[model samples]
Target: MAVLAIDIGGTKCAVALTDASGDILTSEVAPTPSGGDAETLWRALWSLIETTVGAEPVDGVGVGCGGPMTWPDGVVAPLNMPGWRDGFPVVARLRERFPGVPVRIHNDAIALAAAEHWKGAGQGVDDMIGMVVSTGVGGGLILGGRLINGGTGNAGHIGHIVVDPAGPPCGCGGNGCLEAVARGPALAAWAVEQGWVPGTPAAGPVNPELSEREAAALYRENARATGRQLATDAAAGDQIAVAAMNRAGWALGLAIASATHLCDVDLVTIGGGLSQSGPLLFEPLEETLRTHARMGFSSRVRVVPAALGQEAGLIGAAALIVGGDRYWSP
Candidate 1:
């Protein structure tokens, strides 16, 4: 079967058409519309869908939406998306658009897990955790060869798992959540507070001419850049940036250790924008994981970067329809 896959993220929306083998036939992405309001976002997605599916036949639609959503119905109130906090009827709208087809929706991270389990890093692994540590940290779990969905289909929401009781407040209105302490924005904000400037020179003033207000604006801009350059600087031996990355990895390691203790998943496949930082982030993460994962089983779990890269979400979305319940949907 050919499936239409939709990946709705905080900053962008992507659409892809995939064949039964989970190969993307066509795909396209667009920035989430300004304001990110329901109508605007929906229109943007629809346009992308149309563009991706042009002259092609599709049997079903699968959507990967950011969470804090109501499942079975697919009502979303994604925390990072202010315009959607009131909830958007995602599955309902998709069903309305494609009647009589099997339209399925899952959290974006969960969808990525499905993709990884099917054709990416988690292939042949009976139990694993798939994590995306980008603008936020999100995760999905596969245990006993089945996707583990809690009653509300939010089972593998590792991001909100509290790693530190005294850590920063998360957008989910909780303290010390992994997303709040280890994600890109959180790391960048912490680095700025620690005197790291965006365009800091190796051996010169961070910024000589910029006033306090200008510096703050620059921080905002740098924070908006998603901590990628910070990773680069850290790799280049910038102390402040290295500190920030270390903090992020340490926090994540704590969470992963706890998760390993509870579920004992043997593999963690890390994806998303920040995971691209490679060893600069992974070194600290592995070091911390080694320290915290004291139990024999827990210590055995290995963390690795995702193999599918950015297309994991799109492929996972398509897998929702193509792979069916055993391999994809919860």
Candidate 2:
């Protein structure tokens, strides 16, 4: 049976039609309207659901969204998306659209984790870490063949982990949380602070409003920061592009060290746009993780990129509808 899948993220809304095999047959993308109210966001999603269905029938709906949500209830309050206070009832709205069909929602990071563990770089490992390094950094943990969805469905708040204490303040009211220091905005902001921004060289004045990619490009032509060069080829300079990423590289190393020390995981699968930076990101991540990790064979942990690509969520969501009690938080 085919399932309808929806992935709501910081930049855009992505919906697709997929089969049990996790193959996407059709998909669509649209900018998230800025209404800052749950009702308005609901209306926008409702409209998308209508356009997505277009008279075509599907078995069920599976959704993925940013975390700090109340699960089994489908209520979500994402960080980047304002106006979705009190958690949008995505399940209720989806059910409203498809009567008699069940709907399930998950943290996007967890869903991506689910996707990787089931059919990607984690194919052979029973314990693994699944991460998405896109506009922001999000991650999920799978242990002993089960995905860990913490109380209130907020287990994988990886991005919010404390990376730098003196760098910047995060939205979570913490100073130097990983998201604030390592996300796209921080990266761009750091570029401006460092005077590496486009039209604003180290010797020249700074461009306060310049984009991260532009700054990265300018820095690349004039600088030899291999890390920045990798970023330019990776995300094409997205918000999750440069500064946010070096932070991510270092933070991920520390995170893996802690996570591995705690759970003894043997494999790590990284996805999302930031992972696209290739070795520039991983080389540093691996080095740092090995250096600081608690004593053990953590150095043996094999870190690889995810293989499911965009279909990871759809396939993972479908897995939940068919076996949610076994795979995801129910």
Candidate 3:
């Protein structure tokens, strides 16, 4: 029997039909509704779900979502997707849509951790952390071969960990959180503050043409453009871009090292759009890890890129139903 897998994010919603072995039979994606309300977002997700599995029937459904959520109950108030701040009754809706099929919900990062443990970087590892660093930073942990979902299902939320007490403010209302320093927007804003101008495709080898006013407008309007474009610049040897990425990597490495000090996880698998920046990010990350990890065991922990890539969350959702035996341990 196939499992219907759903992944909801701030920018998009994805649905997939997968069998027990993690093969995706069908999949679909849609931009998140621009209205940013619960009903509008649900409409987009419902459309993707129907398009992906309308004719095909599935035995069960599993959902992965970014969260301030209640698992099993499947209610969510994802910080990135404020439309559901009042809390979304996701499991109830899925149950109503697919009557009699088992339905379960997981924090997206936790789901990714489970998927990684089953088939990706954490395979065969008894203790691990899975992290996604893109528009935001998020994480999940597996220790003693059991997925740790804390009292409110928010365990392993490493993003909000305070790293710099005097650093910038975070959306979570904290100061100097890992998310505040290392997320894409933070990196871009830092680069911009240091006078990095975004190069345009049309500008060729010439410096960016935009006046300061025009550049600031672009920066304000397109928050992610800075980080994405800066990655390109860093690859081509732009000093400021490299510095921005280096700072981000250092902050992330510090956070991971701190977490390792506490959990002593054997591995940390990073998956996210930012991870694609490759050595421009990872080099500094490794340096920081080596510099900050004081304990012998913490220094031994391996940090690697996630193998399943973009499909980790979808596969993880499906895994909740198809491979629970492989992941769950008392």
RMSD of each: 3.9, 5.9, 3.7
* Candidate 1 residue pairs in clash (backbone atoms < 3 Å): none
1-330, model 2: which lDDT tens digit per residue? 878888887667888887776677787777888755778777777777677778788888888887767787887888777888566777877787789988888888888888777777887687788877665778888887888776666776777777666858777788777667555555556655554333323322235576766764665566433334336623444333344455567877877777777778888888876677777678778877888774766667877888887668766766666545556555
* TM-scores for all predictions: 0.90, 0.80, 0.89
Query: At residue 89, what lDDT does model 1 achieve?
Result: 93
lDDT against the true structure, per candidate, is 0.84, 0.71, 0.84
Instruction: Say which prediction, candidate 1 or candidate 2, comes out ahead on TM-score.
Output: 1
For candidate 2, what is the lDDT?
Answer: 0.71
User: For model 3, how does the per-residue alpha-carbon lDDT over 246-328 read when each residue is reduced to its tens digit?
Assistant: 99888989999999999999899998878888998999999999999978799898889988877888988988888765443
The number of the candidate with the highest TM-score is 1
Better of 2 and 3 by lDDT: 3
Ten contiguous residues with the weakest lDDT in model 2: 197-206
Q: How close is candidate 1 to the true structure, as a TM-score?
A: 0.90
Ranking by TM-score: 1, 3, 2
Candidate 3, which segments miss by more than 4 Å at Cα?
Answer: 200-225, 325-330
User: Where does candidate 2 clash, by residue pair?
Assistant: 36-83, 182-244, 184-239, 187-243
Tens digit of per-residue lDDT, candidate 1, span 1-330: 788999998888889888888898888999887676778777878899889989787899988988889986899987767788899998999898888998888899999988888898889888899999988899888998778887889889899889889989998888999899988888888988998765444423347797666765665565433477677667667799889989988988989999999998989999987888888889999999999998878889999998897788888888778886754444
